[model samples]
Target: MDLELQTERLTLTPCTDETLLTYSTNGYKLGPHIGMYLEELKKDASALGWGVWLVIDKQTNNIIGDIGFKGKPDNEKSVEVGYGIISTKQNKGYATEALKCIIEWAFNSDSVNKITAECLVDNIPSVKVLQKLNMTKIKNDNHMLYWQLNK
Candidate 1:
């Protein structure tokens, strides 16, 4: 299988019908919600290179989480990102490394000028990941904070 990105400890695998089905059947530990999102991505042709990717732990070859764009870059050449790591896997720095790899992959495209993300204001860990990556806080609403990083 072709990998979308790789870091020192993780391999980011693109979501495809075959891969999702195999992971589901083999009990590879990808969380429940991810399947639904991958199914949705299968319905959109443009999502081929812009959907979620499975995060694989190199040493254990375990499915720890997923990370990827919400969709393809928008008209403004900005893309939004989302990710999740299983509860047991949180705070291990996997999310941060996976995000950095994905960001680099996104910026490799000539059309992508910026990456954006948002999280509930109380989600401190997620906010910290954005901050650690040097994404600037662009705005805040009653319950959410928005951030962006330009290439």
Candidate 2:
């Protein structure tokens, strides 16, 4: 995957097996969930753009966090997005900026017509990010708030 999304202050790099291995070798700790995503990619090469994208801070040239979809778009052409920023990077607009870039990229694809996201009810910052993206609140269940934005 040669795809890279650039923002004013961030660079979004889609993760591949080689990139993940390189990052790990350089001491970037990937969580277990990320490992699962890697396994998914290994099983299906087409999962590239649909999996994790590392969030790199432009100034520092360091991975500050990650943001991406859980998988490819479904039959309805809808995909779910998820994101995280390091505690030190939280409260900054990085999540919003990165997500905005990725959303545009996804919507530009003919395979994707809608983007969905979910966050814990108590996650105020996540709620604000979704609201800023103009994703409508669609459901609330099991303490999770589901949101969707149609292209």
Candidate with maximal TM-score = 2
Q: Give me candidate 1's TM-score against the actual structure.
A: 0.86
The runs of at least 3 residues in candidate 1 whose Cα sits more than 4 Å from the true structure, single-residue gaps closed, are 1-3, 21-37
Could you tell me which residue pairs clash in candidate 2? none
Taking the candidates one at a time, how many backbone clashes does each contain? 0, 0
lDDT of 1 by residue, 28-97 (tens): 4655656766777767766766777888888777777888888889999999999888777899999999
Q: CA shift at 19, candidate 1, in angstroms?
A: 1.9
Q: What Cα-based lDDT does every candidate model obtain? A: 0.82, 0.88
- Across residues 1-151, which tens digit of lDDT does each residue of candidate 2 receive? 2488899999888877766554432334677768898889888989988989998887777788899999999999999999988888889999999999999999988899999999999999999999999999999999999999999
Residue 114 in model 1: lDDT: 93
Candidate 1 lDDT (Cα, whole model)? 0.82
